[model samples]
Target: MRTAVELSWRLLRGGGRRSMVGSLLTLAAVAVSTGLLLFAVGANHAFLQRAHADAWRHPGDSVANPTAIEALSTDYVQGEPVTIIDLAALNGDAPVPPGMSRFPEPGEVWTSPALAHLMKDLPADQLAKRFPSPSGTLGRDALVHPGELVAVIGRTAGDPATTARRDVVEHLGATGGPSRIDRFETDASWSADVYLLLAGLASVLMVVPLLVFGGAAARLTVARRDSRLAALRLVGATPGQVVAITTAEAVLTAAAGALAGLVLYAASVPLLTHITIAGGGWFAGDLWPGPPLLAGVLAAVPLLVGASAVIGLRRVVVSPLGVARRETPPGMRAVRILALAAVVIAFGVAGGGLIDMGRAGMIVLMVFLVLAFLAINFAGPWVVALIGRLTAATARRPARLLAGRRLVDDPRSAWRTVAGVALTGFVAGFLALLNAGPSSGGPPDELRVAVPYERSAAVAGQAEKRLAGIDANVSVKRTETRDDPLDADGPVTTTGVVTVTAPGGTAAVDRARTALTGLVPGKVVTTGADEDVTGDRLLADLRTGALTVLVVSFLIAITSAGITSASAVLDRRQAYAMLRLAGTPLSVLDRARRQETLIPLVVMGGGSLLTGLFFGLPFAQGFGFSGLIGLAAFVVLGFGGILGAGALSRPLLRSVTADPAPRPD
Candidate 1:
């Protein structure tokens, strides 16, 4: 073992410029893959943290012996949602909320840092006057994200605002009445669930491509490594010694790369916090995956690299003479095609909803989706080999012919060059067709507020008196009930709705809205536009998430293409030298190299895109004009990125073929 480690260190340090370059390239690839994987995992953790933080606002079943009463409502200021939680202690022993140091005195309010900042910018009547002067600021544990707007106000038990009444429009998990609770802990809101689902899907999409890239990192400069190992076997080195040397070299390099990746992820956290989701930007701590998960990722990446390196050693280990003679391995079997077909068939059946499994059905669909994604890996090489054979049979140019023979000689290597782009193409297709339908528009200038059913006439009279001085046509009416557009079957019972027609537009609307603030305790004054805010925000969030996923995928794809293309040049240096000596032009070889990546990229990338569209059909509404535009843009960008990556390696190819003289390993 000691001898093998010493030999490995000596070889790595003394292997000249080519070997050092290969090692550096491998390190860079592993670093990129590791950093991306951490980011994907961290995103999932961030969403979960937000969910837990937001859960306190949604109280669960009432306690038998309650100590406090809590009522939740929402207010809108400058088009942003502000969650207001009204609380009254029934006893001195009532439990304190998550971020408060103690139970609040009546009329006291605590605001999130973001809300306090907004209050400083806006006039008192516009926002600050809606609540009593903020007595304290809520801690991070009480807020979903750093930018979330939340306020906790203390009220007397008999305060009108504490009276039980349904909201005009239901926000997430709003029950429309005060709940008796002994504690703040509860399940997360439905919006959190939606965010979580999207996060999980994004993680899966990113993780698969990153894993593929990481494994491919082990195969960089495969030809050189294989020859060097074969020479070791020819010199009578024991198999165990050979394995030890390979493991030491691969593991050390991978471990160093993994550490570098850890640093990269850590450095990116500040930038990641700027990405808004669910109407707020993240807290720095939200993006940190704790020690256990971080350690696991660090260990897992190096082990994966080591395992891949060992797996690629079969030829040298079993038939050293054949490797020394430079024989091409047997072609990959058709079973790869069969395996892919089986997975696709299974996915189709599962997605068809043959059974009424409910939540189980969703789980099954997720499983099939993952299998289908991985199936692309199994199918890619087979498709490349088939493309090579067809190209070889029909190619008329030297560039095309050389490209075909190289693809046939090593389909796996060829597949690696395009795999990232192909995967990203699938992501683009899946996201492109999903459109959140248009917002349900309403009378933009109208303001509606819900009051207690028993006091509808009284509240309406009070509202008229309060808004009498406003320079607008304000009408107050008694409304028996208002139906929740989100929940068609559940109608919220309210006493009255204050309707304001502001001829002066937004300024007048603001005046009317201010006049009606605190008219009914515990009731929110909302505009007709407020009803559409949630839906519009959801759509906007989805678009943002889709863009984020596509950007990350493209980065990975482009990085993979560039690295693999350059590595392929290193692997085939000797071959390029021989071809140059045979009088083949560098231009021809460069064209051949580009064709090798381009041909498979178009064929497999298109296939993957179609498959993604097929999978997304269940969720897609008709494609809007924007959707089509986005789809076209993705295609252009995907192809352009791969072409650019392949082009980056042209200089390396020129250098390799610049010298045609042969050299020993």
Candidate 2:
């Protein structure tokens, strides 16, 4: 145990700055991923809570009137007459109460504080209006008359059988006061949905990279120490001890990193609350790293490292020293079959769930990716053989022949580089395309329109007449909407968007809208693309948020791919040296790496494409995104993979050529 501890400390310090940097870099990646996941999760939880609260605070659920404001009466007095005031007159033509004054103007309506707040700008005092009665109207069905001075109150839901809470009524002013309105509820879902989506995506994104990078680290660290381990074996150390020593060291380091991360995550949760994007609300609570989550983190760290060490050690244990000198290649056939199965299952589940498409397409896509990866991994020799044959004609072509032969000779080494490059190139290009796309040039136009959703036909006609009068040459599009009583405490409006082109810039469109709005102030509200609150814009924002998550995951995957490929190639220095001695040139070596790595790169890229297609095609039926967006993603993925491979190759080549590197005879 002491020896193992001593050895671990020695190894930990051996890499000096490189090891520290590597560990720190790994930690940073993990920390960022974990932190984001926690923040997103917390934000989501808080948002959902607030949504439920807001829903409870409104009273439209039980009320028969769905609208924020209900107009009770609009009666005419004797020819040039005015509305009279009477509490009972709400039901009929009752005379005004003995002493109260009646409003004598048109467009006057009585309303509660909430409703009045929304219409503060309206001349309610001069126009007849009723406020909620002071005692509350819970069971009464009576309405208010012109001069009746009835009160209107805000209602909040409580226990089913109990009296619901009501707020004091107030008259309308130019800047209305607060009343619980139902319209706010419409966009409330977004408050919670954003956090939930972010949290879920962040969690998923972290998992893959942790697995890939952790596995690579363990594999590289253990393999690099095998010579020392073998010497310990000669000194009579048992295999169990070898396993224990190596595994213990790894677990210790991993635990240290995990603890560091946990501490950092806990510390930063407060700051994270304010870090919101896309209208995603703040994180509202302390991060609770409960037993299960903490256990997962602690367990995952050690398990990842330990598993890699065990896998590597098992091979060493099974092989005799003489035979060990000649490393046995991993079987290509086995890996291909396994990877195929994995790819199929994952894609099948994901694709089916995403598109309401049966699980079969998803299954096939997943299976293909897994199979493709396995084939590259296990059937390295077979792939090399195929590539070798394909380029066999170039055997006499010097660099080309050398590249082909080298790839065929040891496909595993060759393909790792390929995978790295492909990942880098694809990511880089995908980002470029996003920036290059016209849609990404600026924020999407904000859609705004006026109210009267049901009366849109009449409203649109009025708008068109007004527009024509102003020489706007505009077209009016009618739309339907459910009122959001909360937004303005009245009937709100919704509409499908309309495009307007009036021989001038957007400014001209605005001017035209202003001219029309001036003509018909209350009868017609804009319900098309000219309104301030367009549902489509919100929907688009949500879609953009989802896309952002996908892009971030892709980037994390690229970084992970680089680490895995570099570590894998670096661990097999002896094998590469042997290949070099056998006269493999740099070009052939690079080709083999590209082939192996590209298999997975292409598979993942294809999988992403299919995933997008599943969503985009159906969505396009309603709203379209350009096909070039997806195509660009694929191209970027390919280039990223290539670049990553090339970058990792330098250290790989150096490692391969370093001597006295052990020779695999």
Candidate 3:
């Protein structure tokens, strides 16, 4: 073990360019995977942390609607759902609510790091927006930004001892008379569990691609390694020794990358804190992962790498002679079809019983989702084999014939090179169908509104008064929604919506919306209409979130194709050299390699599209499936895959063809 580790380390530092490149590629792949996995995981944690922060911002206070004019000047702080929030006074003169321990004083205020970060660092003129003072005077401008702490106004300004006891003289201007103070924050329409589930699902998508990346990293220079290990076998090194040495190399590379990834994550905290979600970016502290999870991530990455490396050598370890005479890999079995068929039947049976997507049904759905993903993996090689056979039978030229023969000869290797691309396409296709689904976007007749949670009565009065002025005949209804946590099919934190009846027409409804806007200095969103709200932000984020994983998968697919394609040529250098000596054209072999990649690109890409639609159609919401968009995406991916493989195969083709070197005995 010691000898193997020493040799591995020595080889990593002292090996020639090819060996060094392999090590670097392995390190790069592992680092990228680790960093992204952590980011997804960290973002999940941040969502919850931000939620808890929102919950803690007000304790013991159930009513958030303001009744006084003093806090109104600076009271309009934006909230999680982007509503205007008015702080209340804990002043002795004002009648305080029984539920409140203490409220913020007139000039005192609380804010998250995201808000403070956005406001504090600007010029003196802009600093005024950080905490607007009713009395035109704020304390000295802050030179340094606070780290993770919630920015508190009046910390350096207000005299807490005297301010709470100070007299409250009534002053009415554009606003009405001052009354009792109350504050309430809107609870997320859905529960934490739903967001948590979404985060988990997103993480799975990212982590799966990364697992493939790590696997590819382990096999970076397999053919060369096989040759090197074969020479060792002939020179009396035991099979176990060879495996130990390779595993040592993979572990060292993976460990270095994983550690570097942790460093990168730590460095990215400041930036991550600025990604606006919910209503704002997360606090720096809110984004930090706990020690146990961090430790687990660090341990898991290298172990995965070492295990994959060891597994890649199974045949070699079992028989050293067999390693030297590696055969064309076997094609996938017919069992892949059975697995897919079983999934469809199970989905049908379970769909019938699980009519309502209750907790049990959701659990079953989750299982089906996992099965669908696995089925794609299981069924991929089988489809590739069938495509290969079909193409071979149909081949009319040398390039096509050679490519078809290669696919049929070693379908598993071909599948390995392009599987990531296929999976990415499938995932992308399924996601596109979401927007196509019926219930995804807002409805036409409903208008979305975010009124003060406790100001339901006030909002109704104001809304009615405004609507009465409008030339159009429109009425507004206050919408209240409640979620049952125990119900699996239940709604998550759903945003409240106002149903606007434009009895007059669309023009009348438009006039009514204008009147409502003129009544308040706040935002109003209309569902099925043009209105901006948190849902828009959340959905946009959800749609793009998978893109990062897809990109990582694409990179891995390209890298794997390039390295493995180059290795294919290098592995058969002797055979190519002999062919060149017999006057075979370099272009012929070049075309052969291109054909190999092009054929698989078509086969795998088509299979991916089919699979995506299979899963996506059954699950699409009331929104019609966007078959056109999916088709376009599939076409683009297919073209890109083919071009990428052909491009990567070019440089290696030149080197292998240009050199007619003798093979080592």
TM-score to native of every candidate shown: 0.94, 0.54, 0.69
State the local distance difference test value for candidate 3.
0.56
Q: lDDT of all predictions, in order shown?
A: 0.82, 0.42, 0.56
Candidate 3, residues 1-665, lDDT tens digits: the string is: 99999988887887666567667766776777677667877877776654443332222222355332222111211211211223344433433321233444656555444445544443322233334442221111110112322333322113322222211111211111122334332242133345555666666655665676666667766666776777687789887888889889889999998988888778888887765443345557656677787888888899998998888786666666766776655456899978977987787666555536655765666567667667766786677677777878998976677667767876655666666677666666655555522124454434445543455456656676766755432334445354785787776543333445544544444445445542333243344433333345455455445454455555545655555565566555556677677777787767766776667667666766666655566555433334464456556755676566667757766765676766553
Quote the positional error of residue 592 for candidate 2 in Å. 6.4
Best-to-worst lDDT order = 1, 3, 2
For candidate 3, what is the TM-score? 0.69
Error of 2 at 597 (Å): 4.6
Tens-place lDDT digits, model 2, residues 22-87: 444444444444444443444444545434432221222333322232111111111011111112
Measured on C-alpha atoms, candidate 2 has an lDDT of 0.42
Alpha-carbon lDDT of model 1: 0.82
Residue-level error in angstroms, candidate 1, position 21: 1.0
Backbone collision tally, model 2 = 78
**Among all windows of ten consecutive residues in candidate 1, which has the lowest summed lDDT?**
168-177
Scored by TM-score, the top model is 1
**Which model is ahead, 1 or 2, in terms of TM-score?**
1
TM-score-better candidate, 2 vs 3:
3
> Order the candidates by TM-score, highest first — what do you get?
1, 3, 2
